[model samples]
Target: MRSLVEAQISRIKRCIGERLLTQELASQEGEGVIIANLLNRWNAFGKPVCVKNA
Candidate 1:
């Protein structure tokens, strides 16, 4: 799931960096909601330990 998480993070950063350009991108992909939820949890309690597999 590392790749999945990384993909989500990349998408999120892209969305943030290019909000106007990617406004519809997230909605169309549907992973936006999942990313938001994950981000919220990460912000609240820091990233999960399991994600540091590198």
Candidate 2:
């Protein structure tokens, strides 16, 4: 569960960062969307989506 959360957080961070770099989204707005998506997925699943560590 921890791993899944971490992975999701990492991906969100990366996406927002890329968007920021491209000037496609303001940092705050990008982050807000990322959090919203993450929470939505978490709530929908009701369980951690585990990812295997590579």
How many steric overlaps are in each model, in order? Answer: 0, 0
The residue-by-residue lDDT of candidate 1 on 1-54, one tens digit each, is: 999888867866875653433457756466556656766876788555765566
The residue pairs in collision within model 2 are none
* Residue 3 in model 2: lDDT: 100
Expressed as tens digits, the lDDT of each residue in 1-54 for candidate 2 is 999888877875675553333344587687677667866876687655799999
The lDDT of each candidate is: 0.65, 0.67
Best by lDDT: 2
Query: Which residue window of length 10 is worst by lDDT in model 2?
Result: 15-24
Task: List ranges where model 2 is wrong by over 4 Å.
Answer: 1-25, 47-54
Tell me, by TM-score, which candidate is best: 2
lDDT over C-alpha atoms for residue 48 of model 2: 57
Candidates in order, TM-scores: namely: 0.32, 0.38
